[model samples]
Target: MDEALLRSLTPSVLAVLVRRGADFAAAEDAVQEALVEAVRHWPDDPPRDAKGWLVTVAWRKFIDTTRADAARRRREDRVEEEPPPGPASSVDDTLQLYFLCAHPSLTPSSAVALTLRAVGGLTTRQIAEAYLVPEATMAQRISRAKRTVSGVRLDRPGDVATVLRVLYLVFNEGYSGDVDLAAEAIRLTRQLAAAIDHPEVAGLLALMLLHHARRAARTAPDGSLVPLAEQDRSRWDTKAIAEGIGILQKALARDRLGEFQAQAAIAALHADAPTAGETDWAQIVEWYDELAGLVDSPVVLLNRAVAIGEAHGPRAGLAALAELDDSLPRHTAVAAYLHEREGDLTKAAALYAEAAHKATNLPERDHLTRQAARLNAKRRA
Candidate 1:
């Protein structure tokens, strides 16, 4: 009856099917069908062993589908001898599932969708709603992803960095519809950290926790974006922040510096601050330097500019920003903030208006529009 429990068991169940010689695509479909049946029946007739129940039902479903398909006739003979229903294997297949779902053959969007569905146990409609896309469009994307990875061998190890990137992408999506993707990403990352002793894995989990701890204060009552410096720190989850800092500290001790660890180091600094004005921007700028060395992303440079503005002065930040491409997303907004910090009200207002026109999301556009209006009003007064 516990939906989260069922979803959590999904990847392992599918892995069992794949291990038993079932193809990935068919095994995934069977697992989904079993999940639907569980939702319909589990509340009224709960099973003694949830994972075993799912494996039995899904394997039968796989066999039935394979037998019906002439193209899969070769698989029908092997699956005809159904494995006896019993307790699920003690061996954890969740890690392999993570690798398989984040396989490099698929596009980023496709990988995210497949990971959510096959590993996260989200339905296609749920994923579509979370992404604010049409169900059919999401369905096609997931289908293509499955086909792309169908030929891939599950026995081989997968790239850890690719898996981390996929998880980070999920975390950055925040929350929408019925899924809190950020929390889901944290859960999966925690699972990954337990399975592997990698510092980057721990680092990513820490970063997610630190960011998620501030979710409550990230928006106003009317769903308006609240700048980090302006957020009410009283609302932040102290426990999560503490845990994040602890995890980050251990990862940092490992000395295997990675992008996520660098980012978490920055987040820990922010959380350590008693107030916005007390933030250690100089240390943060140093961390940004590390992050810049890890990746040459323009967004990272833009963020470093903001840190420079805080650590040095507005003019210094402007100088750093001047080296980046003007067409980058949020560049104008960053420029506007720097100009405002320099007390150039007219330039700030105009830049804010321009940024609002180019904003990608509703909340951001509304926030930028308000900034522009506030500055325009100030100029008139």
Candidate 2:
């Protein structure tokens, strides 16, 4: 059985049931049941039309479940006569599904979970494993999310920005357990891009590809984090980089510059560089300026400060950093780097130690500690 094919068909199949008057929760559950059946039987006897098979099986499952429920007596009348097994309707509701899964009514975590299950075609257990949470916990989160959107009608358009934000959140999760959420987010975003003609969608896909292209060199053999400037360029995926650059170029040409596009521009700039020293920091600072204007985020400005430090001088970067709140994440680390560049080894070492103490994860803390040690040893020499 082609698992990818099955997952690809899941959203459209679930959408068919929902369009045919099934509630979102019941329809999603029924679609999952259909997927299980496919996994069990498709190996011995694959259907000619996968989507149609799923739609038929899922609709029947929904009807059966609705009929069995005492509280859903009124819903039974609508699902009493199951549609005959035939080709599923070609009316794609995947875009609508994306918007619904990212509904503002749901919390960010719930939205990500629901998008993975209902849109990305992932199982609750898979999502649970990826998030390092209990299966029961993830199940409850998805259940609540489905219930929250159950009453919402898919008659109006959804907020595209919300959908993009949810996808970005998924991408930022990177990888955990058996699920590479970043890859899953890319796949789902690709699906969304196919459904909608939005430049931001294309921009997001480009950004994911560019970032993912460098995954092989992001860590050392000891699983230690490697800074971008130190990563081996030979390890990068050239194919993915080329593809990302192409997509980004097309999106930029459309003249609809959103935050994602601006971000992709920065990623593309990094990917374009053949060596760390050859990076166009000035251009990157300009992109960061554009990104800051688009989002008004402190993190964006923080990053811009790094680019400014590289583009101009360490003192200039320090000047930019001083104007912002020092409480931002990674603020101390950036300060350390800038101080070190300004030939203030003692101050840099102290700041690195402080950043390590504030680190949120083990790898980051270890990396920062190593930086402090290196600076202190240099001073001793």
Candidate 3:
């Protein structure tokens, strides 16, 4: 069976059930049942029209479920009559589904989980594995999310910013277990971009492509984190970078700048450079300024400190860093880098060790620890 085909068709099939009067939660459950049937039977007897098959099976499943539940008998009248089986309606409610899954009523974690399950066509187990949570925990989260948005009609527009933020959260997850959430996020974003003509959407896609292009070099052979400056540029995916640049240029040309577009511009500038020394830090600092203006986020300012250090001087970067709260995540690491650039190895080494102790993940902690060790060894020599 072509697992990809089933996943790709899941949203459309579920949408058909909802458009036919099924509630969001029940329709999604039925679609999942249909998928299981397909996986079990498709290998021996594949249908000529995969989508039409899924729609039929899923609709039947929905009808069966609605009739069987005593409390949902009232809903049976709405779905009693089934549409004649034929080619599935080309009217794509996938976009509407995207908006619903990303509805503002849901928390960020709930939205991300629902998007992966309903929009990204991922199983609760798959999503749970990706996030390192138990399957039952993810199932409850998704169930609650579905109920929260079940009463919501798709007659109006959804907050695109919310949807983008959800997708961004997915991308940041990178990969784990059986799922590469980053790749799944890129796929779902591409689907959204095709359905809508929004600059920010294109900007987000460009950003993901550019960042993904460097995934191969983000880690050393031993799975340690490699800073962008130290990464081997040769390992970067030039094709993805080129595509991202092309998309970003078009989005930027639209003159509707957003935070993602600004971030992509910074990524594009880095991708354009031949080496770390050749990077146009001045342009990057400018982009960071634009990003800061677009989103009042201290994290952006913290990053800007690094760019400021590269563009102006170590002292300037440290000054910018000093303005932010010292309790901010990665604040110590950034200070360490700036101090190292300023030739204060003693302070830098101490800061690196401090940052390592505060690191959230194993790889990052190891990288920071190594930085401190390297500087300490240098001092001894």
Candidate 4:
């Protein structure tokens, strides 16, 4: 299916069509046409200027569609042969495309779907697979997202931040479905960072890299979640780690310290240690504290509890965790860790079982279940 050709051409295809002034609907249709053409032609004559050819052809096709639709005749000249001179000359249209895909007017799910389609060059079926939904469901989602943004004006400056956040979510899941969402996210974020001047975008890229560096060690081949301390330190991606640290250091020096920057700081601290034992728990706790203040989310608080536990004592961690809601998903797991640390193996084993049952994903469930099994094995021994 000309996979490499498609992957290489996709970002540019979407970007050029959009930059030529096609709205989401038109740009999407144009890119789809280009894909169909690629499938038909790439076996014989691969165009020399693949991206340019796709963009030029898609732009023309989009213009034709707009002209034929009586309703769209009002702006037949919506796009000029060449765009006017603008701010940020070095800025690429791909960044603008991200903002459009992540337009707040669209629902979060829809935004994700659109971004996958437009930027990731994924078909509707692929997006549906990742989201664990039907292809038809995801198609409707993309379509609705397109229609929702048709009326909204989107050239504002603040739009880039929203775009960066949406991409951040894509990277955070690490991996999903058949696609490596984390890799796709890193690719897109790099595109955005290169095209834009925003420091937060750089910060998001740094954060994604830091988290992604740990992915190889995050899970075992059997799909078991590897605890941070148990992870094979050698498996960590040193290149991603170095890049993350360099970018993070630069962002921290800016003194903006946005939420993304704070999270990156925490990740950087963890990555700096030779082993989990060598981790700067005190600094990590401080970063988590800053993050909690910036985002005010319970998840951050729960994570901070773990850091506090490492920095101080298990009992202190438990005390901090006690302040959070019992309904939180991390509730039982944190309790089990605290109990185990405080020398209550029996109670800890019981809590581990509960945590396993409550776990959301397969790896996490398996991890907690194994924790219980270890404690059980000790009893039998």
Off by over 4 Å in 3: 70-78, 84-92
**Residue pairs in collision within model 3:** none
Ranking by TM-score: 2, 3, 1, 4
Q: C-alpha displacement of 138 in model 1, angstroms? A: 1.9
| Cα lDDT tens digits for candidate 1, 14-126 | 98888888999999999999999999999999999998899999998998888888455544365688765435542347788889899998899999999999989999999
Weakest ten-residue segment in model 3 by summed lDDT: 83-92
Once superposed on the true structure, which residue ranges of model 2 sit more than 4 Å away at CA? 70-76, 84-91
- Each model's lDDT comes to 0.93, 0.92, 0.92, 0.81
Error of 4 at 221 (Å): 1.9
Full ranking by lDDT: 1, 2, 3, 4
Candidate 4 segments exceeding 4 Å error: 1-12, 15-21, 63-92
The true-versus-predicted C-alpha distance at residue 178 of model 1, in Å, is 1.5
Q: Any idea how many clashes model 1 has?
A: 0
Clashes of 4: 0
Error of 1 at 135 (Å): 2.2
**Which stretches of model 1 miss by more than 4 angstroms?**
70-76, 84-92
Cα-based RMSD of candidate 3: 1.8
**TM-score of every model?**
0.95, 0.97, 0.96, 0.89
lDDT of 4 by residue, 132-219 (tens): 8888988889888889877665465447778877897787666668988888888888878787867788889999999899998987
